[model samples]
Target: MTAVPQPTAALLDGTALARELTARTAESAAELRRRTGTAPCLATVLVGADPASVTYVRMKQNSCAKAGIESRHVALPAEISTAGLVDAVTALSEDPAVHGILLQHPVGAHIDERAAFEAIAPGKDVDGVTTASFAAMSFGLPGFVSCTPGGIMRLLDAYDVELSGRHAVVVGRSPILGKPAGMLLLARDATVTYCHSRTADLRAHLREADLVVAAVGRPRFIRGEDLKPGVVVVDAGYNEGNVGDVDFDSAAARASLITPVPGGVGPMTIAVLLEQTVEAAWRQLVS
Candidate 1:
Protein backbone atom coordinates (compact mmCIF):
# COMPACT_ATOMS: atom_id res chain seq x y z
CA MET A 1 0.00 0.00 0.00
CA THR A 2 1.23 3.49 -0.85
CA ALA A 3 1.86 5.83 2.05
CA VAL A 4 -0.43 8.90 2.10
CA PRO A 5 0.90 12.43 2.51
CA GLN A 6 -0.10 14.23 5.67
CA PRO A 7 -2.84 16.81 5.40
CA THR A 8 -1.79 20.46 5.35
CA ALA A 9 -2.60 22.59 8.37
CA ALA A 10 -5.76 24.66 8.29
CA LEU A 11 -5.34 28.25 7.10
CA LEU A 12 -6.39 30.92 9.62
CA ASP A 13 -8.35 32.83 6.92
CA GLY A 14 -8.14 36.36 8.31
CA THR A 15 -9.94 37.82 5.32
CA ALA A 16 -13.16 35.99 6.18
CA LEU A 17 -12.91 36.99 9.81
CA ALA A 18 -12.21 40.60 8.82
CA ARG A 19 -15.32 40.66 6.66
CA GLU A 20 -17.40 39.54 9.61
CA LEU A 21 -15.88 42.19 11.83
CA THR A 22 -16.48 44.86 9.17
CA ALA A 23 -20.17 43.93 9.02
CA ARG A 24 -20.47 44.26 12.77
CA THR A 25 -18.62 47.56 12.68
CA ALA A 26 -20.99 48.85 10.03
CA GLU A 27 -23.97 48.05 12.24
CA SER A 28 -22.36 49.80 15.20
CA ALA A 29 -21.53 52.82 13.02
CA ALA A 30 -25.07 52.98 11.71
CA GLU A 31 -26.50 52.93 15.22
CA LEU A 32 -24.07 55.64 16.29
CA ARG A 33 -25.16 57.75 13.35
CA ARG A 34 -28.82 57.29 14.25
CA ARG A 35 -28.12 58.47 17.79
CA THR A 36 -25.86 61.40 16.95
CA GLY A 37 -26.43 62.16 13.26
CA THR A 38 -22.67 62.06 12.57
CA ALA A 39 -20.49 59.12 11.65
CA PRO A 40 -17.14 58.31 13.16
CA CYS A 41 -14.16 59.93 11.39
CA LEU A 42 -10.56 58.76 11.16
CA ALA A 43 -7.69 61.09 10.23
CA THR A 44 -4.89 59.22 8.43
CA VAL A 45 -1.52 61.05 8.33
CA LEU A 46 1.19 59.93 5.94
CA VAL A 47 4.65 61.52 5.96
CA GLY A 48 7.06 61.31 3.03
CA ALA A 49 6.06 59.74 -0.26
CA ASP A 50 6.85 56.13 0.49
CA PRO A 51 4.80 54.18 -2.02
CA ALA A 52 4.10 51.41 0.45
CA SER A 53 2.81 53.83 3.07
CA VAL A 54 0.64 55.54 0.47
CA THR A 55 -0.88 52.24 -0.58
CA TYR A 56 -1.48 51.18 3.01
CA VAL A 57 -3.25 54.46 3.78
CA ARG A 58 -5.46 54.10 0.72
CA MET A 59 -6.39 50.58 1.73
CA LYS A 60 -7.35 51.86 5.19
CA GLN A 61 -9.54 54.58 3.70
CA ASN A 62 -11.34 52.07 1.50
CA SER A 63 -11.95 49.81 4.47
CA CYS A 64 -13.33 52.76 6.41
CA ALA A 65 -15.81 53.51 3.65
CA LYS A 66 -17.02 49.93 3.62
CA ALA A 67 -17.59 50.05 7.38
CA GLY A 68 -19.58 53.32 7.28
CA ILE A 69 -16.72 55.38 8.73
CA GLU A 70 -15.29 58.61 7.34
CA SER A 71 -11.57 59.04 6.68
CA ARG A 72 -9.57 62.29 6.32
CA HIS A 73 -6.17 62.03 4.65
CA VAL A 74 -3.21 64.29 5.54
CA ALA A 75 -0.14 63.97 3.37
CA LEU A 76 3.02 65.75 4.51
CA PRO A 77 6.19 66.24 2.48
CA ALA A 78 9.19 64.05 3.19
CA GLU A 79 11.16 67.02 4.53
CA ILE A 80 8.47 68.05 7.03
CA SER A 81 10.06 68.75 10.44
CA THR A 82 9.23 66.81 13.59
CA ALA A 83 7.69 69.88 15.16
CA GLY A 84 5.50 70.43 12.11
CA LEU A 85 4.35 66.82 12.15
CA VAL A 86 3.60 67.01 15.86
CA ASP A 87 1.59 70.16 15.35
CA ALA A 88 -0.45 68.53 12.58
CA VAL A 89 -1.24 65.49 14.72
CA THR A 90 -2.08 67.68 17.72
CA ALA A 91 -4.53 69.60 15.54
CA LEU A 92 -6.23 66.35 14.60
CA SER A 93 -6.33 65.29 18.22
CA GLU A 94 -8.21 68.46 19.06
CA ASP A 95 -10.56 68.21 16.10
CA PRO A 96 -13.92 67.23 17.56
CA ALA A 97 -15.02 65.81 14.21
CA VAL A 98 -12.17 63.27 14.08
CA HIS A 99 -12.82 60.24 16.26
CA GLY A 100 -9.52 58.53 15.50
CA ILE A 101 -6.01 59.38 14.25
CA LEU A 102 -3.66 56.99 12.39
CA LEU A 103 -0.12 58.13 11.71
CA GLN A 104 1.62 55.83 9.26
CA HIS A 105 4.86 54.40 10.61
CA PRO A 106 8.47 55.16 9.52
CA VAL A 107 7.64 58.83 9.19
CA GLY A 108 11.13 59.61 7.75
CA ALA A 109 14.48 59.78 9.57
CA HIS A 110 14.18 63.48 10.36
CA ILE A 111 10.90 63.20 12.32
CA ASP A 112 10.60 62.11 15.93
CA GLU A 113 8.04 59.33 15.43
CA ARG A 114 7.31 58.72 19.12
CA ALA A 115 6.63 62.37 19.79
CA ALA A 116 4.22 62.53 16.88
CA PHE A 117 2.42 59.43 18.11
CA GLU A 118 2.18 60.93 21.61
CA ALA A 119 0.56 64.05 20.20
CA ILE A 120 -2.58 62.10 19.41
CA ALA A 121 -5.01 62.50 22.32
CA PRO A 122 -5.72 59.31 24.22
CA GLY A 123 -9.42 59.56 23.46
CA LYS A 124 -8.68 59.79 19.72
CA ASP A 125 -5.71 57.48 19.60
CA VAL A 126 -7.74 54.71 18.03
CA ASP A 127 -4.60 53.37 16.33
CA GLY A 128 -3.31 52.74 19.86
CA VAL A 129 0.27 53.95 19.38
CA THR A 130 0.30 56.37 22.31
CA THR A 131 2.03 55.85 25.68
CA ALA A 132 -1.40 55.76 27.28
CA SER A 133 -2.46 53.01 24.89
CA PHE A 134 0.60 50.95 25.74
CA ALA A 135 -0.24 51.22 29.44
CA ALA A 136 -3.81 50.14 28.74
CA MET A 137 -2.59 47.15 26.74
CA SER A 138 -0.21 46.07 29.50
CA PHE A 139 -3.01 46.29 32.11
CA GLY A 140 -5.66 44.60 29.94
CA LEU A 141 -7.89 47.64 30.28
CA PRO A 142 -10.85 48.49 28.06
CA GLY A 143 -8.94 50.69 25.58
CA PHE A 144 -8.07 50.58 21.91
CA VAL A 145 -5.16 48.26 21.20
CA SER A 146 -2.49 48.45 18.54
CA CYS A 147 -4.28 47.53 15.31
CA THR A 148 -2.16 44.57 14.16
CA PRO A 149 -1.95 43.06 17.63
CA GLY A 150 -5.67 43.59 18.16
CA GLY A 151 -6.32 41.89 14.82
CA ILE A 152 -4.15 38.91 15.72
CA MET A 153 -6.16 38.41 18.90
CA ARG A 154 -9.39 38.57 16.93
CA LEU A 155 -8.09 35.96 14.48
CA LEU A 156 -7.09 33.59 17.28
CA ASP A 157 -10.48 33.98 18.92
CA ALA A 158 -12.24 33.30 15.62
CA TYR A 159 -10.47 29.97 15.30
CA ASP A 160 -11.25 29.13 18.92
CA VAL A 161 -7.56 28.77 19.75
CA GLU A 162 -7.23 28.24 23.47
CA LEU A 163 -4.70 30.65 24.96
CA SER A 164 -4.79 29.73 28.63
CA GLY A 165 -1.40 28.50 29.83
CA ARG A 166 -0.08 27.98 26.33
CA HIS A 167 3.54 28.90 25.64
CA ALA A 168 3.36 31.69 23.06
CA VAL A 169 6.68 32.97 21.80
CA VAL A 170 6.51 36.22 19.89
CA VAL A 171 9.55 36.88 17.69
CA GLY A 172 10.04 40.67 17.55
CA ARG A 173 9.89 43.49 20.07
CA SER A 174 8.60 46.47 18.16
CA PRO A 175 6.23 48.60 20.23
CA ILE A 176 3.36 48.34 17.75
CA LEU A 177 3.29 44.70 16.77
CA GLY A 178 5.70 42.41 18.59
CA LYS A 179 5.63 43.77 22.17
CA PRO A 180 1.93 44.56 22.07
CA ALA A 181 1.19 41.16 20.58
CA GLY A 182 2.94 39.40 23.45
CA MET A 183 1.04 41.48 26.00
CA LEU A 184 -2.30 40.66 24.38
CA LEU A 185 -1.42 36.98 24.44
CA LEU A 186 -0.52 37.26 28.10
CA ALA A 187 -3.80 39.02 28.78
CA ARG A 188 -5.58 35.89 27.63
CA ASP A 189 -3.58 33.85 30.14
CA ALA A 190 -1.01 32.59 27.68
CA THR A 191 2.57 32.16 28.90
CA VAL A 192 4.27 34.65 26.57
CA THR A 193 7.95 35.12 25.70
CA TYR A 194 9.34 37.98 23.61
CA CYS A 195 12.35 37.43 21.38
CA HIS A 196 14.15 39.76 18.99
CA SER A 197 17.22 40.13 16.77
CA ARG A 198 19.39 40.03 19.89
CA THR A 199 17.90 36.78 21.16
CA ALA A 200 20.44 33.98 21.45
CA ASP A 201 19.51 30.64 19.91
CA LEU A 202 16.23 31.91 18.48
CA ARG A 203 15.40 28.46 17.16
CA ALA A 204 15.56 27.06 20.69
CA HIS A 205 12.99 29.54 21.89
CA LEU A 206 10.67 28.77 18.97
CA ARG A 207 10.96 25.03 19.42
CA GLU A 208 9.29 25.30 22.83
CA ALA A 209 6.45 27.54 21.68
CA ASP A 210 2.91 26.18 21.57
CA LEU A 211 2.01 29.35 19.71
CA VAL A 212 4.31 31.47 17.51
CA VAL A 213 3.79 34.97 16.17
CA ALA A 214 6.24 36.20 13.52
CA ALA A 215 6.27 39.99 13.34
CA VAL A 216 9.94 40.59 12.71
CA GLY A 217 9.39 42.20 9.26
CA ARG A 218 12.08 40.00 7.74
CA PRO A 219 10.84 37.73 5.00
CA ARG A 220 11.03 34.03 5.84
CA PHE A 221 12.80 34.76 9.10
CA ILE A 222 11.13 31.81 10.89
CA ARG A 223 11.83 28.47 9.30
CA GLY A 224 9.74 25.32 9.65
CA GLU A 225 12.68 23.60 11.37
CA ASP A 226 12.39 26.07 14.23
CA LEU A 227 8.72 25.43 14.93
CA LYS A 228 7.16 22.95 17.32
CA PRO A 229 4.71 20.61 15.68
CA GLY A 230 1.05 21.43 16.40
CA VAL A 231 1.94 25.03 17.16
CA VAL A 232 -0.36 27.86 16.22
CA VAL A 233 1.43 30.35 13.93
CA VAL A 234 0.43 33.92 13.24
CA ASP A 235 2.34 35.79 10.51
CA ALA A 236 1.84 39.52 10.96
CA GLY A 237 4.74 40.74 8.81
CA TYR A 238 3.82 42.66 5.68
CA ASN A 239 6.73 42.99 3.35
CA GLU A 240 6.63 43.64 -0.37
CA GLY A 241 4.01 41.76 -2.40
CA ASN A 242 2.32 40.41 0.75
CA VAL A 243 5.28 38.26 1.80
CA GLY A 244 5.30 37.03 5.43
CA ASP A 245 8.07 36.52 7.95
CA VAL A 246 7.59 32.75 8.10
CA ASP A 247 8.64 30.27 5.45
CA PHE A 248 5.01 29.41 4.80
CA ASP A 249 5.71 26.38 2.59
CA SER A 250 7.56 24.70 5.44
CA ALA A 251 5.96 26.31 8.48
CA ALA A 252 2.50 25.37 7.25
CA ALA A 253 3.52 21.75 7.13
CA ARG A 254 4.49 21.82 10.80
CA ALA A 255 1.94 24.25 12.21
CA SER A 256 -1.53 23.15 13.29
CA LEU A 257 -2.80 26.62 12.37
CA ILE A 258 -1.23 29.51 10.45
CA THR A 259 -2.18 32.86 8.98
CA PRO A 260 -1.25 33.80 5.41
CA VAL A 261 0.33 37.13 4.48
CA PRO A 262 -1.87 39.25 2.24
CA GLY A 263 -5.22 37.86 3.25
CA GLY A 264 -4.20 37.12 6.78
CA VAL A 265 -3.13 39.83 9.20
CA GLY A 266 -3.40 42.53 6.54
CA PRO A 267 -7.17 42.77 6.28
CA MET A 268 -7.69 42.33 9.99
CA THR A 269 -5.55 45.37 10.84
CA ILE A 270 -7.86 47.71 8.92
CA ALA A 271 -10.89 45.99 10.43
CA VAL A 272 -9.71 46.80 13.92
CA LEU A 273 -9.00 50.39 12.90
CA LEU A 274 -12.55 50.87 11.66
CA GLU A 275 -14.03 49.12 14.69
CA GLN A 276 -12.11 51.30 17.09
CA THR A 277 -13.10 54.45 15.25
CA VAL A 278 -16.74 53.63 15.76
CA GLU A 279 -16.10 52.84 19.42
CA ALA A 280 -14.43 56.22 19.88
CA ALA A 281 -17.38 57.97 18.36
CA TRP A 282 -19.80 56.19 20.67
CA ARG A 283 -17.73 57.08 23.72
CA GLN A 284 -17.52 60.70 22.65
CA LEU A 285 -21.29 60.88 22.29
CA VAL A 286 -21.89 59.25 25.65
CA SER A 287 -19.31 61.32 27.47
Candidate 2:
Protein backbone atom coordinates (compact mmCIF):
# COMPACT_ATOMS: atom_id res chain seq x y z
CA MET A 1 0.00 0.00 0.00
CA THR A 2 1.24 3.47 -0.89
CA ALA A 3 1.67 5.90 1.96
CA VAL A 4 0.37 9.49 2.05
CA PRO A 5 2.83 12.28 1.25
CA GLN A 6 3.25 15.35 3.44
CA PRO A 7 0.49 17.94 3.38
CA THR A 8 0.94 21.39 1.91
CA ALA A 9 2.72 23.82 4.20
CA ALA A 10 1.10 26.91 5.64
CA LEU A 11 2.35 30.06 3.98
CA LEU A 12 4.48 32.29 6.21
CA ASP A 13 3.27 35.71 5.16
CA GLY A 14 6.30 37.94 5.55
CA THR A 15 4.36 40.87 4.21
CA ALA A 16 1.89 40.78 7.08
CA LEU A 17 4.60 40.12 9.60
CA ALA A 18 6.77 42.89 8.21
CA ARG A 19 3.86 45.28 8.36
CA GLU A 20 3.30 44.43 12.00
CA LEU A 21 6.96 44.67 12.85
CA THR A 22 7.40 47.96 11.03
CA ALA A 23 4.38 49.40 12.73
CA ARG A 24 5.93 48.62 16.08
CA THR A 25 9.24 50.09 14.97
CA ALA A 26 7.48 53.20 13.80
CA GLU A 27 5.92 53.65 17.17
CA SER A 28 9.35 53.40 18.75
CA ALA A 29 10.73 55.85 16.23
CA ALA A 30 8.02 58.33 17.10
CA GLU A 31 8.63 57.87 20.79
CA LEU A 32 12.35 58.32 20.36
CA ARG A 33 11.89 61.57 18.49
CA ARG A 34 9.44 62.86 21.08
CA ARG A 35 11.84 62.07 23.89
CA THR A 36 15.01 63.39 22.22
CA GLY A 37 13.50 66.19 20.08
CA THR A 38 15.14 64.68 16.96
CA ALA A 39 14.46 61.71 14.77
CA PRO A 40 16.81 58.77 14.63
CA CYS A 41 19.05 59.00 11.56
CA LEU A 42 20.43 56.31 9.27
CA ALA A 43 23.20 56.97 6.76
CA THR A 44 23.20 54.90 3.59
CA VAL A 45 26.51 54.73 1.72
CA LEU A 46 26.51 53.24 -1.75
CA VAL A 47 29.58 52.78 -3.95
CA GLY A 48 29.12 52.67 -7.71
CA ALA A 49 25.93 52.99 -9.76
CA ASP A 50 24.67 49.45 -9.80
CA PRO A 51 20.99 49.73 -10.71
CA ALA A 52 19.85 47.03 -8.30
CA SER A 53 21.85 48.50 -5.44
CA VAL A 54 20.36 51.90 -6.15
CA THR A 55 16.88 50.47 -5.98
CA TYR A 56 17.60 48.75 -2.68
CA VAL A 57 18.97 51.93 -1.11
CA ARG A 58 15.93 53.85 -2.27
CA MET A 59 13.66 51.29 -0.69
CA LYS A 60 15.45 51.60 2.64
CA GLN A 61 15.28 55.37 2.49
CA ASN A 62 11.58 55.25 1.76
CA SER A 63 11.03 52.90 4.66
CA CYS A 64 12.94 55.25 6.93
CA ALA A 65 10.85 58.19 5.91
CA LYS A 66 7.71 56.20 6.58
CA ALA A 67 8.93 55.34 10.07
CA GLY A 68 9.85 58.98 10.84
CA ILE A 69 13.51 58.03 10.76
CA GLU A 70 15.87 60.39 8.93
CA SER A 71 17.93 58.99 6.02
CA ARG A 72 21.15 60.39 4.62
CA HIS A 73 22.18 58.94 1.26
CA VAL A 74 25.78 59.13 0.04
CA ALA A 75 26.47 57.89 -3.46
CA LEU A 76 30.12 57.38 -4.42
CA PRO A 77 31.68 56.95 -7.84
CA ALA A 78 32.13 53.46 -9.21
CA GLU A 79 35.86 54.02 -9.58
CA ILE A 80 36.48 55.49 -6.14
CA SER A 81 39.57 54.13 -4.40
CA THR A 82 39.06 51.87 -1.38
CA ALA A 83 40.79 54.40 0.88
CA GLY A 84 38.62 57.21 -0.39
CA LEU A 85 35.45 55.20 0.17
CA VAL A 86 36.60 54.18 3.64
CA ASP A 87 37.31 57.79 4.48
CA ALA A 88 33.79 58.79 3.50
CA VAL A 89 32.20 56.04 5.60
CA THR A 90 34.43 56.81 8.58
CA ALA A 91 33.35 60.42 8.40
CA LEU A 92 29.73 59.37 8.62
CA SER A 93 30.59 57.12 11.57
CA GLU A 94 31.74 60.19 13.42
CA ASP A 95 28.73 62.29 12.46
CA PRO A 96 26.68 63.16 15.52
CA ALA A 97 23.37 63.06 13.60
CA VAL A 98 23.86 59.61 12.11
CA HIS A 99 22.61 56.81 14.33
CA GLY A 100 23.10 53.93 11.91
CA ILE A 101 25.24 53.28 8.79
CA LEU A 102 24.62 50.89 5.93
CA LEU A 103 27.28 50.37 3.27
CA GLN A 104 25.40 48.99 0.28
CA HIS A 105 27.27 45.84 -0.73
CA PRO A 106 29.26 44.68 -3.79
CA VAL A 107 30.90 48.09 -4.23
CA GLY A 108 33.13 46.78 -7.05
CA ALA A 109 35.70 44.11 -7.77
CA HIS A 110 38.49 46.65 -7.41
CA ILE A 111 37.30 47.81 -4.00
CA ASP A 112 38.10 46.03 -0.76
CA GLU A 113 34.62 45.42 0.67
CA ARG A 114 35.90 44.39 4.08
CA ALA A 115 37.89 47.55 4.52
CA ALA A 116 34.90 49.69 3.60
CA PHE A 117 32.63 47.76 5.98
CA GLU A 118 35.10 48.13 8.82
CA ALA A 119 35.15 51.86 8.32
CA ILE A 120 31.61 52.08 9.72
CA ALA A 121 31.83 52.17 13.51
CA PRO A 122 30.42 49.09 15.19
CA GLY A 123 27.84 51.17 17.06
CA LYS A 124 26.57 52.49 13.72
CA ASP A 125 26.69 49.20 11.79
CA VAL A 126 22.94 48.80 11.55
CA ASP A 127 23.24 46.55 8.52
CA GLY A 128 25.47 44.34 10.66
CA VAL A 129 28.06 43.31 8.03
CA THR A 130 31.24 43.91 10.01
CA THR A 131 33.21 41.20 11.83
CA ALA A 132 32.26 42.92 15.09
CA SER A 133 28.54 42.36 14.58
CA PHE A 134 29.15 38.81 13.36
CA ALA A 135 31.09 37.99 16.51
CA ALA A 136 28.37 39.47 18.68
CA MET A 137 25.71 37.54 16.80
CA SER A 138 27.68 34.29 17.04
CA PHE A 139 28.22 34.71 20.76
CA GLY A 140 24.62 35.85 21.46
CA LEU A 141 25.87 39.10 22.91
CA PRO A 142 24.23 42.51 22.72
CA GLY A 143 24.86 43.93 19.26
CA PHE A 144 23.15 44.58 15.95
CA VAL A 145 22.53 41.56 13.77
CA SER A 146 22.75 41.22 10.02
CA CYS A 147 19.35 42.54 8.89
CA THR A 148 18.25 39.49 6.89
CA PRO A 149 19.37 36.96 9.48
CA GLY A 150 17.83 39.00 12.27
CA GLY A 151 14.55 39.14 10.38
CA ILE A 152 14.54 35.37 9.91
CA MET A 153 14.81 34.89 13.64
CA ARG A 154 11.81 37.17 14.13
CA LEU A 155 9.77 35.08 11.70
CA LEU A 156 10.61 31.84 13.46
CA ASP A 157 9.74 33.23 16.88
CA ALA A 158 6.58 34.85 15.57
CA TYR A 159 5.38 31.49 14.39
CA ASP A 160 6.60 29.75 17.58
CA VAL A 161 8.81 27.21 15.82
CA GLU A 162 10.93 25.13 18.16
CA LEU A 163 14.65 25.88 17.76
CA SER A 164 16.36 24.17 20.64
CA GLY A 165 18.00 20.92 19.61
CA ARG A 166 16.38 21.10 16.18
CA HIS A 167 18.59 20.25 13.23
CA ALA A 168 18.93 23.33 10.99
CA VAL A 169 20.66 23.05 7.61
CA VAL A 170 21.64 26.37 6.08
CA VAL A 171 22.33 26.45 2.34
CA GLY A 172 24.71 29.26 1.53
CA ARG A 173 27.66 30.80 3.34
CA SER A 174 27.88 34.37 2.18
CA PRO A 175 29.17 36.58 5.02
CA ILE A 176 25.94 38.53 5.30
CA LEU A 177 23.34 35.82 5.23
CA GLY A 178 24.22 32.13 5.45
CA LYS A 179 27.12 32.18 7.88
CA PRO A 180 25.44 34.56 10.31
CA ALA A 181 22.17 32.64 10.01
CA GLY A 182 23.79 29.40 11.11
CA MET A 183 25.51 31.17 13.94
CA LEU A 184 22.19 32.50 15.17
CA LEU A 185 20.58 29.09 15.07
CA LEU A 186 23.55 27.55 16.80
CA ALA A 187 23.39 30.20 19.47
CA ARG A 188 19.77 29.28 20.05
CA ASP A 189 20.77 25.67 20.72
CA ALA A 190 19.96 24.31 17.30
CA THR A 191 22.20 21.70 15.74
CA VAL A 192 23.28 23.63 12.66
CA THR A 193 25.08 22.42 9.52
CA TYR A 194 26.23 24.55 6.61
CA CYS A 195 26.07 23.53 2.93
CA HIS A 196 27.84 25.71 0.47
CA SER A 197 29.26 25.61 -3.09
CA ARG A 198 31.63 22.80 -2.10
CA THR A 199 29.05 20.54 -0.52
CA ALA A 200 29.08 17.16 -2.28
CA ASP A 201 25.74 15.94 -0.92
CA LEU A 202 23.39 18.82 -0.38
CA ARG A 203 20.29 16.67 -0.42
CA ALA A 204 21.69 14.42 2.28
CA HIS A 205 21.76 17.35 4.65
CA LEU A 206 18.32 18.56 3.60
CA ARG A 207 16.80 15.19 4.39
CA GLU A 208 17.78 15.58 8.02
CA ALA A 209 17.06 19.25 8.65
CA ASP A 210 14.15 20.26 10.84
CA LEU A 211 14.58 23.72 9.42
CA VAL A 212 16.12 24.86 6.10
CA VAL A 213 17.28 28.32 5.12
CA ALA A 214 17.99 28.66 1.36
CA ALA A 215 20.18 31.69 0.82
CA VAL A 216 22.19 30.68 -2.23
CA GLY A 217 21.55 33.20 -4.99
CA ARG A 218 20.43 30.67 -7.55
CA PRO A 219 16.71 30.72 -8.30
CA ARG A 220 14.76 27.60 -7.46
CA PHE A 221 17.93 25.62 -6.76
CA ILE A 222 16.38 23.69 -3.84
CA ARG A 223 13.47 21.43 -4.72
CA GLY A 224 10.66 19.85 -2.69
CA GLU A 225 11.78 16.28 -3.12
CA ASP A 226 15.08 17.02 -1.47
CA LEU A 227 13.48 18.21 1.81
CA LYS A 228 12.31 16.04 4.62
CA PRO A 229 8.60 15.92 5.35
CA GLY A 230 7.37 18.68 7.64
CA VAL A 231 10.59 20.66 7.36
CA VAL A 232 10.30 24.40 7.90
CA VAL A 233 11.73 26.34 4.94
CA VAL A 234 12.90 29.92 4.79
CA ASP A 235 14.00 31.03 1.30
CA ALA A 236 16.11 34.13 1.75
CA GLY A 237 17.10 34.45 -1.91
CA TYR A 238 15.70 37.44 -3.80
CA ASN A 239 16.93 37.10 -7.36
CA GLU A 240 15.66 38.90 -10.41
CA GLY A 241 12.16 37.98 -11.62
CA ASN A 242 11.03 37.75 -7.96
CA VAL A 243 12.34 34.20 -7.70
CA GLY A 244 13.79 32.49 -4.62
CA ASP A 245 16.55 29.98 -3.97
CA VAL A 246 14.10 27.17 -3.17
CA ASP A 247 11.41 25.89 -5.55
CA PHE A 248 8.50 27.36 -3.62
CA ASP A 249 5.69 25.32 -5.11
CA SER A 250 7.36 21.97 -4.58
CA ALA A 251 8.90 22.81 -1.24
CA ALA A 252 5.61 24.14 0.09
CA ALA A 253 3.96 20.87 -0.73
CA ARG A 254 6.37 19.01 1.52
CA ALA A 255 7.13 21.52 4.27
CA SER A 256 5.12 22.52 7.31
CA LEU A 257 5.73 26.26 6.87
CA ILE A 258 7.62 28.38 4.32
CA THR A 259 8.30 31.98 3.40
CA PRO A 260 7.64 33.45 -0.05
CA VAL A 261 10.20 35.32 -2.11
CA PRO A 262 8.94 38.82 -2.84
CA GLY A 263 6.86 39.19 0.30
CA GLY A 264 8.83 37.11 2.74
CA VAL A 265 12.34 37.94 3.82
CA GLY A 266 12.58 41.20 1.89
CA PRO A 267 10.30 43.31 4.05
CA MET A 268 11.54 41.79 7.29
CA THR A 269 15.10 42.83 6.44
CA ILE A 270 14.15 46.47 5.97
CA ALA A 271 12.01 46.39 9.09
CA VAL A 272 14.90 45.09 11.20
CA LEU A 273 17.18 47.78 9.82
CA LEU A 274 14.70 50.47 10.74
CA GLU A 275 14.14 49.05 14.19
CA GLN A 276 17.85 48.85 14.88
CA THR A 277 18.37 52.39 13.69
CA VAL A 278 16.03 53.66 16.36
CA GLU A 279 17.67 51.50 19.01
CA ALA A 280 21.09 52.80 18.04
CA ALA A 281 19.87 56.34 18.44
CA TRP A 282 18.44 55.61 21.86
CA ARG A 283 21.63 53.88 22.99
CA GLN A 284 23.80 56.69 21.71
CA LEU A 285 21.81 59.18 23.73
CA VAL A 286 22.17 57.26 27.00
CA SER A 287 25.78 56.20 26.46
Worst 10 residues of 1 by lDDT: 2-11
Clashing residue pairs in candidate 2 (N, C-alpha, C atoms within 3 angstroms) = none
- The residue-by-residue lDDT of candidate 2 on 185-250, one tens digit each, is 998999999999999988999999999999999999999999988999999998889999998988
Best by lDDT: 2
Q: What's model 2's lDDT at 184?
A: 91
Which stretches of candidate 2 lie above 4 Å from their native place? 1-7
RMSD (Å) of each candidate, 1 decimal? 2.1, 2.3
Score every model by TM-score: 0.96, 0.96
Residue-wise lDDT of candidate 1 within 1-287, one digit each (tens)? 95433537899999999999999999999999998899999999999889889988999999999999999999999999999999999999989999999999989987889999999999998988998999998997878899999999999999999999999999999999998999999889999999998999999999999999998989988988898789999998877756899988788888999998779988899899999999999999766
